[model samples]
Target: MSTRLRCLLAASAVALTAACGVGDQAGSNTVTMTVWTSNQAQLDLLNRLADDFSAQHDGADVRIQSVPQADYTTKISVRLAGGDAPDLGWLGAPDAVGMAASGQLADVGPALRNDPEYRFDDFVPAAFTNWRGGDAVYGVPFSTSPFFVIYNKDAFATANLPEPAELAARGDWTWDRLAGLARDLQPSLPRGHFVFQSNEGSVYGPLPVSWPTLDPLLRAHGAGFYDPQTKRCTLDSPAAAEAVGTFHRMAFDDRTAVPPGAQADFYAGNAAMTITQLSRLSQLEGAEFDYGIAPLPGGPGGQPHVTGQAGLVVFEQAPHKELATELLKYLTSEKAVRELAEFYPPARTSVLADAPEIYRDSRLSEQAVKDILVPGITEGHAFQYPRTWPEIKTTAQPVFDQLWSPGADVGSVLGRLCGEVGPLLKQAE
Candidate 1:
C-alpha cells in the first residue's frame, strides 16, 4: 500500500481503538479540536471560548488547532477518508454539503433540539438551509457575512469623485455608474494604483475563489450558474452576458480593474474599492489612509445582496462526538455568537436587531455599520452551491479563463460554459 494509504489505515486503527474506549477515556479529561481559521483575532476569541468551556467542566480541557483556510477542506477530507478526523472543524457552505452528503459529518440536530437553553429558534432560519441534509443538521452556521464595497476615502477625494455611499444615498449607485466612476478615477490615481479589486485580486484561476468575485456581478444582472430548484444553467442569458461583458470591459478594455496578474489592495490604499466582507476591516486597524464601507452597487436587476456563509461541524469519525457536539453548541450559543460578532456577523435575529450596539466598537462607525453592513447581512442572499460544486468549478475553470482574453466574446464563452457544466449540474440533482 502507498504511504498515504498506510497512514490512513494506521489512523483508522487508532480511530477504531478510540471508538472502543481506548482514547478520551474518563481519566484522560481532555479534548482537542482542529479548526480552520488563521485570523489571530478569530483564533483569540475561539481560544477564549475554549478556556471558558474548560472552566465549566471539572477535570476537562479543550485545545484548538488552527489550520490555514486554503488547505482546510482538503486536509479535513483526507483525514476523514484516512480515518483520522478532528473532533470538530469549521466548514464553508460548499464543503459542508459534500461532507454531509458523504456521511462524514455527524448530525447535530438531536443535540441542538435537546438543548432548550441553546435557543435554536434564535438563529436566522435561512442560515440553516445550507447545513441541512434531509432531516439531519450537519453544521451550525457561525458567520453569515455579506459582501460590500470597501473604498479608500482618500482616493475618492483625490479623484474628486462622489463616494459609493453618496451615490447609494441618491439611488444612483448602479454597476454601470460604479464602472464609470472607476474608469474616471483611474486617471487620477498614482501610477500602479487602480480603481477596483475583486475578492483576492484576480479571477483567472481557482474556481472557488473566482466564483465569489463573479457571483455578485452575475446576480446583479439577473444571472446565476444554475437555478437551485430547476438545476439549469443560466449563464447564457442576456443579463449574464451583459454582466460578464461589463466586467470584461473593465478588466481588459477600460483597464479600470486590476488586471489578471497585477496586485492592488483597497485596505492598503493601492486601489479605490474592493468587494469583500466587513470581517476584512480587521486589516484596516492601522491602515495609513482613510477608508469607508458601502453597500455593493446595484445592477440592472436591482440590489442583489450576496453573503458568504460558514459553519461548525463535528466529524462522524470523531472520537469525542458528544463532546464535539456540545462544543459546537457552546460556540454557537447566544453569548458566544454575540462575542464573535466583533469579527463575524452573527446570524441570530436578536443579535442582528441590536447590531448597532453589538458592533459599537468595530472599526467602522456605528452609523456606517448600520447603514452599509447591517442591511447587507439582513437582506443578502447567501452564495448558492450544489453538491457537485467542487467538480463543476474545476470543469468551468478553463472556460472562465477565456474571459481574460482581450476581445473575448462573453456570450460565447458563457454559453460554452453552460454546455459543459449543464450535465454536471444535472448529475448533482
Candidate 2:
C-alpha cells in the first residue's frame, strides 16, 4: 500500500470498524459468505439462491448485501483496506483492473480449472479481458451488457418520428439523427420533461461511475478520458470537444436533453430516450408506458459498441477461502447463470445461444434481441480505467461541472480538465 492509501485507511479506521463486521461467522463446518450487489430488487431471488446453496452444502450461510451503485467502489475500497472485505462482490469492468492491480482480488483460476463441470471454457473470451491478469483469472463476468438506446415508443409516435429501430434497419440510425429527434420531440413534451437523459443518471459522477455517463458519447466520437498506452489525458481532443459540444447544445441551446441540474428518468416516461443495457430492462418490465430497444446510434466513430460488465470476484482477504470458492462455483454454474440471464446479459456462450428465445417474450422482442442486444454483447468493448482514476475524479469535479453551462466553451473546458488530471493519469501506478 502507498503512504497516501495507508493514511486514508488510518483516518477511516473508526468508521471502518463500525461498518465492517458482517462477513465472519464462527461455527463447525459453517461459513458466512458475504456478497454485494447493486440491485436490491433481486434480493429475494439472491437470498433464494443462497438458501439453495446452504441446503446443498451442509448449511453454510450466505448473505447478499446491496450497496448503492454510486458508492460501491469507494466503500469496497475502504472495506478491503480495513481487512473487512466481503467474501464475494460484483466489480464493474472499469473498476476491476484497479482493484486487481491493487492486490485486493483473488485468483480463482485453479479452482475453476479443477471443476470440469464448471465449464470455464464456456465463458465468452471477450468478457475476460478486464478480469484476467496474464494466466490468472481474478474474476468472471456475470453481466456483459452492451450499451444501447432505449426509447419511449409513445413519445416517438407523438412526435411523428420513425422508431430508432426503423432508422437502424434503414442504415440511418446515427448520433446526428438522435440529436435531431430529441430536438424535434421536445415541443410535444410538457414542461420539465426532456427528450433525452444521460445514461445511468449522473452526467459526471464522482466515484463509482465516473466515465460510464459520457463513455458512449466520447467513444462514439473516438475520444476517451485517457489513452491506456500513452497514459495521458485525452479529453481535450477535437473529437471529445465535438462530442461534449453536441451534448451542451442539447442541454442548453436546444433545451432538449435533461441538464445537469434537471430531473428526467427514461424509465419513468419523463424522457424520450436513454442509453442503457439489458440489466436495466427489469426496470421497464412493469412500467406503464411502452418502450423500444434499438442499436446504439452510430457516430463519427462508426457506432462504437461499448459494453459495461459486472464480474464476480472472491476477495483475497475473505475469511473462508474454501467456502467462498465453493459459493462462487455454485453461483456461476450453468443453471444459476441461465437464471441470471433472464434479468441481466450473460457472458457464457451456452446461455447466449438460447438467450433470444428467453428474452423474446420479455421486455425485448425477439427481433430486437437478435438484432441489437445479442450482437452488442458479442462485439463490445469494456471500459477500462487506470488505478489512479479515483484520484482524477476527485481533483476534476469542479472542472467537470463547468463544461455543462451554456456559455462554457467545450474545448476550453475539457482542456482545463485534462490540464488538472493529466499529471495524475501520467503518473498512475
Candidate 3:
C-alpha cells in the first residue's frame, strides 16, 4: 500500500473506533466529519451547529476535521478506498457524482422522507440535481451558489467604460460585449493590472475546479461538457470552439485575462472584473476599491446561468449512520438553513422569498441578492459532472494545457479532447 493510503487507514482506524462507540446507549459518543474549509467564520458557524446538535442529543458529540480545498476530494477518496471514511462530509458537485457511482455514499432519501418537518420539498430541484443517481439521492445540497461577474466599478469609471450592471439593465450585456470592454480597458489599467480573472485566477488547481470558470462560457455559447441525453462529449462542437476561442484570445491575443501561471486578484483591485460565486463576497469586505456584482453576460445562445453546488453527504461505511443522518437533517433544517444563508445561498423557497432580509448581513445589497443571486439559483443549471470525471479530467489536462499557448487551435485541441474522453463519458452512461 502507498504511504498516503497507510496514513489514511491509520486515521480511519482511529475515527472508526470513535464512531463505533457513538451508538452505545450508556456512554458518550462522538461523530466525526470532514470539510474542505478552514475559514474561521464558517468553522465557528458549523461548530455552533454541532454544539447545538450535541446538546439536543444525550451523550452525543460532533467533531469536525478541516481539510484544504485543493486536497479535499483526494483525501476523501483515499479514506473511502482505505475503508476509513468519515461519517459525513461536504462533496463538491463532481466528487458527489463520482462517489455515488462508486457506491461509497449512502442514500439519504429514506431519512429525508421520514422527517416530515424537514420539508425536503422546500429545496429547489436544481440544488440536488447533481447529487441524484438512479433512485437514490446521495447527498443534500448545502451550498447552491451561482457564478456572477464581479467588476471593479472604480476601474470601469476610470476606463470610461459602461458599468456591467448598467449594460445588463439595458439588456446589452453579452459575452462579446464583455470581451470587447475587457480589451478596451486593458490599456487603461495600471501596468501590471488585468482586465479579468478567470475563476480563482486560473492557477490550474484541478480540472474539476475549472468548471465554475469554463461552464458559464460554454453554456453561453450553447455548448456544455456533454449532452445529457446522449452522454457524449460536446467540447468539439462549433459552439464550444467559439466559446473557448474567445477566451483564448482574451488570454493570449488581447492580453486582458490573466494567463496560465499568472496571478491578478479581483478583490485586491488588480483586475477589472472576475467570474465567481456569491460566497466570495466576504473577501471584498473592507475593499480598497468599489466593486459591483452582476449576472453573467449573455452569449450567442442567450443568457445561460450556471450554478455551482456542494452537498452534505454521509459515507456508506459510516459506523454511526443513524447519528450522521440525524446530523444532516438538523443541519439542513429550515432554521439552520437560514443561519447558513449568511455564507451559502440557501435553496429553500421560503428563504429565497425572504432573501432581502436574509441577505442583509451579507456585503451585497438587497437589490444585488434579489436581482443576481436569487435568480441565478432559481434559473441556473447545475454544472455538468459525469461519474467518470476524475479519469476524464486526467486525460484532458494536457490538452487544456495546449490551449493556453499563443495562437493555439482551440477547435483542434478541443476535438482531440473529445476524442480522448468520449469513450470514458460513454462508459459512465
Candidate 4:
C-alpha cells in the first residue's frame, strides 16, 4: 500500500478501537476538551477526529470553537486573559514568542517524551525550533505551509513572458529578474491590474506577501532586523534601508503589484502573478484557469526565502489541559500528519519522507516543505526569517503611503523610515 494509504488505514484502526472502547463503557465519562480552530476545513477535520477521541475515552466530549480569521488571535487572547479560555487553542507560530511569555502554554516536554510515536525529531527543524524554548516543547506543529509565486498562466502567455517552469530550470528567475518582469509587464496591464495583495489595506497585507518571506530577501542582501545574541532589532541598518528602497520601487514605481484593491484580479486572469500562501491551494480546488507555482525568486545572495506560519498551543490554565496536550500529540502523529497531507504537508520530517505525494503538488510548495523537513537540505534556511515582523510593517505604512504618490523623493522617505524604526528595533531588544 502507498504510505498515504497506510496512514489512513492506521488512523481508521485507531478510530475503530476507540469506538469499540466507547461501546464497552456503560456510564463512565472523561473530561470535556475544548479546541479552538481557525479555518473551516481544519474545524471539520478536527470534529471528525473529535468523534474518534470521544469514542475512545468514553464520555470525553471534544467541543470545538470555530473562530473567523479576523478575530482568531484577539478573541483567543481575550478569553485566555479573562480566565475563560478553552483547554486547547490555535496559536500562530510566528506569534508564538509573544504568546509564550503569557505563562499559559504548558511545557509539553513530558508529553513529547512519553509519546515515542509522536517523536520530536520527526518534525521539520524550523517547526521544531519555533515550538521549543528552554528545552521544552510548548506546542505540536500542525499544518506546514510555504510561500510561492502563484502566477496566472494565461496572463504570462498573454504578455509573451517566459514560462515559470523554464525560469526555474534555468536558474535565471532571480528576484531582480522578477522585478524587471514586473516592470516590463506594468505598462501592458490595466490601471489596477498587477499583483495580488492580501490584507494590505487593513494592515501590511498577509504574512505570505510581506514579512517572513521578506526576511530571507533582506538577509540575502546582508541585512537582518534582529541580533539574536544581543536580542536587538536592527531594522534601521543600511541593509534594511536598501530592502525598503527596493520595496518602494516595486509597489509605487514599477506598479507591478497592488495593495488591497482587487484580489480576484489574479483569480480572474487580470493579474499576472501573486506571492501568496500555498494553503490558498484549498481555494483553487475548482479553479478554471491554468496556473503554475514557483519558489519565490532568489536575490543577489543566491537564496530564496519562503514565508511560513506555525501551529496552535494549549494553555496551562485551560480546563482539561492534559486532555488538550494528548489531543495535540495525537493531531501531530504520523497518522494524523498523513491524513492532513491531503490538503497540507505534515510538519514532521518522518511524515514528509513517508508521504511524497504532498510534496509533489507544486514546485514552490515542494521546495518549502523540503527546506523544513530536511536539515541543511536547502539554501533557504541559511537566510534569516522574521518570526514577529508586524512591527516593521507598522513602520513602513506611512513610508509606503508617501512613496506611492507622484514624484515622491524615495531616498528622503527611506531615510525618515530608518530613523523612526531604528529606535523601535533597539527597544525590542
Kindly provide the TM-score of model 3 when superposed on the true structure, using C-alpha atoms.
0.92
* Weakest lDDT window of 10 consecutive positions for candidate 1: 1-10
In model 4, the runs with Cα more than 4 Å from the true position are 1-41, 195-209, 259-264, 285-288, 359-429
Clashes (N, CA, C under 3 Å) per candidate:
0, 0, 0, 3
- Candidate 1: give the clashing pairs: none
Clashes of 2: 0
TM-score of each: 0.90, 0.86, 0.92, 0.77
Candidate 2 — which residues are off by over 4 angstroms?
Answer: 1-24, 36-41, 51-59, 65-78, 207-210, 285-288
Kindly indicate the candidate among 3 and 4 with the higher TM-score: 3
Local error of candidate 4 at 81, Å?
Answer: 2.5
State the lDDT of candidate 4 residue by residue for 73-92, as single tens digits.
66566656655555666666
Error of 4 at 258 (Å): 1.5
| TM-score of structure candidate 1 | 0.90
- TM-score winner, 1 or 3: 3
Q: Across residues 271-339, which tens digit of lDDT does each residue of candidate 2 receive?
A: 888888776777885687888888878788887777888888888888777788888888888888888
Top candidate on TM-score is 3
lDDT, model 4: 0.57
Instruction: Candidate 3: list runs displaced more than 4 Å.
Output: 1-28, 203-205
lDDT of candidate 1 over 1-429, digit per residue (tens): 100000111233355335433234423454556666666677778878877887776535565655566667666677677666667878889888877767788999989988899988888777876888767899998899888888899888987899998898899988899899988999999898889889867566677777667888888887887898989999999999998888888989888898877888877878888988777777887788888777887787888777889999898988778787888999999999999887789988888888989888777788877876777766777866777877888898888888788879999999999998999889887
